[model samples]
Structures are given as structure tokens and as C-alpha cells.
Target: MIAEHAVPTSVELLRLDADSPRTAEVRRKVVGLRLAPGQQRFSGEAAHTLPRADTDPNRVPFAVLYRQTPVGFGIIDQRGILDEITAAPAEAVLLRAFYLDPEWQGRGIGRTACLALDPLVRSVRPEANEVVLTVNEANPAAVRAYRSGGFTATGERYLGGDAGPQLVMRRPVPYEGGAGDG
Candidate 1:
């Protein structure tokens, strides 16, 4: 268990599934996760998003862990899941509903978790060559965090979001055999 004031040094992404032994505990943690004030205008809470992800075959939910304790959540959407919202290419996966509990923010956990997405998505969707996401134009912190984690703005705007406009961003999924492997 993580201490209330302790900072996590590492982050890991675990697939959320009913069959896992830690499922109940992780779910409880996710249910209690809170976002900072005004953050809700940018991202969805895990508790609310989990149910939809549970029923959608194209959306794979993951629990973000720190020292084996759940502290955040994210979802990777397969090609067809966000076709209308993202207009991403066939080889891209959508990163959605990503958030770290308010208490866990600013500790580098979110950045580490974002960096881990490539391998996680590659393991599940081998054909995915890039990861795409939309960050609210008003949420500069999130945009910086995503940028620090290797995503770059695609110069496109998504106006379909509930909270005004969003900036589309993307990053290449690193090759399994390392750079220039292709």
C-alpha cells in the first residue's frame, strides 16, 4: 500500500479484467479516484468510464499502478472505436479516459504511465503503429504532460468534445526491434 504522502518512483500499466485477483481492490480504488478541480472538464472519471469500457469490446481498460497500488486509469481504443471522433488511420490506437488520482498527479507517475502505453498497446493490438488522443485546448497542463511523454500536436481540432474544442495529438509506437527495425 502507498502512503498518503509518499511519492511513487515508478508506474506500471495492468490490464483490468474480472478474472484478476486484484480486480476488486483495483475497482474500489478506481471508484474512489478523484480529479483536481476543473479537471473534469478535461477528462472523465474512472468510475464513470469503467462501465462503458467493460461492455465495449474495442476499448481495453487499464489500471495505472504505483508500487503495485492502483492510482490511475486509462483506456486504449482499437481502430473502429473512435473512427468518427478521431479520424485516425487504421494503424493508430486511441488513448482515452486517462487520468491520475489528484493525489498522484505531479509526481511523474502520469508521464511514466504514458510512456508505457506503447508496449501495452503493441502487445494487445500488434498492428497499431501510433497512439492518438485529444487534449482539451484549455487544459495546458495535460497538453504539456502528453507532450513530455512524446505526443505532438497534429494541428487538428476536435470540436465534438463536451468541453469546447480539443487538440489532436499523436506519437509513433516504437518498433519492437528498436529504431530502424523496419
Candidate 2:
């Protein structure tokens, strides 16, 4: 089943089903989506390496959909957090390889998806409190998008990225309490 959550900008993040025809379509389109010279490091192809249920049972890949149409892709995984650029807390999730199709860029899909990730990730990683990602400093556009979507720089820099130095960013998950508040 493709799990989805309503988000702003009429975009929803759907859990990618590797065996589904939809996944193939997204993959085909991803091959043609070009990223800016500095943003190529965040290719959707890298997202494909994240473990799925059939592979590791702990990682998840998501397809960004605009009105039920696939427009982007990303992955959220807890693995390698301890060894990745930043030492995220045990309850923190690593948002990796987030990329929007070139055709869908500049339409706010990226920011909307970033904001909507809280609920989408909670569906599987309910304990996750903060989502972390490292963006190449060279990719100012991405850094701007993420910052606009509520992520803040963590003052941590990693020079291991192929594109150059990367800055660590973190966004705390919004609290969702059950029942009425008032």
C-alpha cells in the first residue's frame, strides 16, 4: 500500500513501492530530471540505495506527488546516523537524497514536502523528534529551500561531500497530540 499524507501546495509524499508500476514511472522520470551543477550530489539515484522493507526493513523511500502525480523523491532512514556527518540523537531521523524533478522545481514542492515530512515520517518512525540532513554549501538554492521550510543550520560542516563542504541542518518534528487541545 502506498502511504500518503496531505501537505500544503497540494503535494503529498507517498511511500515508494519499488515493485509498483508507479515506482518505475518515477524512476524513468528521475533519470531525465536534471539538477543544478552544484546539486547533482543529491540525485534521486542515491536514494535508491536506501534499504527498503524487502531489503533492510528499517528504511523508507518516498515519492513526492503533486495532485497524485509524482514530482520528486526522497528517503528517510535511521541507519548510519551514528557514523554520518553529524551524530544525530537516537530519535533523530536522517532525511537523505531529497530531489525535485526539474519540471517541478520553483513551484514550492520542495518546501512543502520538507514541511510535510513530519507526519509522513511519523507513520513509520513515530519516535523521531528531529530530521537531519547535510546539504552541500555549494548548493545555496537547496540550503535556501530547506531553511525556508523551517530547518536551521546546526553549525556543523562536513568536507567529505564530493561537491565540496556540506552544512548540517536540522528541523524539529512538529508535535501531534491526540484529541482536542481546548
Candidate 3:
């Protein structure tokens, strides 16, 4: 059972290690991650997604931590769906398998985690200039969260998703250094 907490906590994204003890704990927590019935159609459980990410060289898995506890999961795809489903620049990275545990939802953790993705993506894929994701048309809450986190719809709909049509959204990866800072 998930512990019930009333206050929103700090959110951070940490790269996961398939063999680490901390990751093992996270894996256990993932088994209990619950999504609403409607959400089940749009996002995948981390328990299933993480194993695939572990074997894919181009995919980087991240554990979303809130108050130092694992509360969500996400993956950064280097080039998996670029031309296959969506058209994006070569420097763009795909945000996949992103979802928070239902118990942790609505506390602004998702938006905070989304805002924290830029640095994490840059750390792993320095050449990435933008982050792109496809949200099912039925998932308005997710679209709103992504928008709040700085993504904008590209007016393109992807029909390849199994659930239904999806909107392609993207946001530029913010650069840390200013002009002449190199």
C-alpha cells in the first residue's frame, strides 16, 4: 500500500541502474504503482517498461523521485520513433513511458518532474536540443501537464498509437550556458 502524504514534495529525476539495490527497491514500488482505469490506456506500467528499456541501448530509464522516494518512471528514447511515427529534428529526444503513481498524482509532481527532465536529458544526451512526446487525444490531463512543463502541440496527429490518435508535442531543451560562457 502507498503511504498517504498531504504535502507536495521535491521532485528529481535520477538515471536508473538495472543492477542497483536502489533500483530494486524502485522496482518493488513499481509493482504497486497504480493508474486510473482511463490512464491505463494511455501509459504503461514501469514494471513492464523498465525491462525493455534495460535492454535497449538507445533508451535511458529514469526513476522519478519525490521526497527521496520513487514515485514515477520515464524513458528518453534517442531515436526510436523519430521518423517511424513522428517527424522531429535529429537533435530531438523522445520522452516515453512517462507516468506517476496514482497516489502521487495531482500534487504537482508530474509538472515538477517534467521541468526537471531537461537537465537529465542533457546529461545523458548532450546533443539533444528538444524533447518530444505523443499524448493520446483522450488524455487531457497529461496534455495539460506537458503544456505546463513547456511543451506545445505541433498540430500534427500521430495515428500509429494502439490506443488512438495522439498529439505530437515538443519543447526546446534549455541550455545552461549563456552567450560567451563556454
Clash totals, every prediction: 0, 0, 0
What tens digits encode model 2's per-residue C-alpha lDDT throughout 38-95?
4566554434453343375666777788887777777787764535654545767788
Cα lDDT, all candidates? 0.82, 0.71, 0.80
Q: Rank the candidates by lDDT, best first.
A: 1, 3, 2
lDDT of 3 by residue, 1-182 (tens): 32333334467787875578887777777656766667888988887888898888989888888878888888999977777544545778899999888777877788778878878888778877788899999899899989977789989888889899999998778666742211
- Model 3 off-target regions past 4 Å? 1-9, 84-88, 179-182
TM-score for each predicted model, relative to the true structure: 0.88, 0.78, 0.87
List the pairs of residues colliding in candidate 1. Answer: none
lDDT for 44 in candidate 3 is: 85
| Model 1, residue 6: C-alpha shift (Å) | 13
TM-score: model 2 vs. ground truth: 0.78
Q: After the best TM-score superposition of candidate 1, give how far the Cα of residue 30 lies from its true spot, in angstroms.
A: 1.5
Error of 2 at 142 (Å): 0.7
**Which candidate wins on lDDT?**
1
Candidate 3, residue 174: lDDT = 62
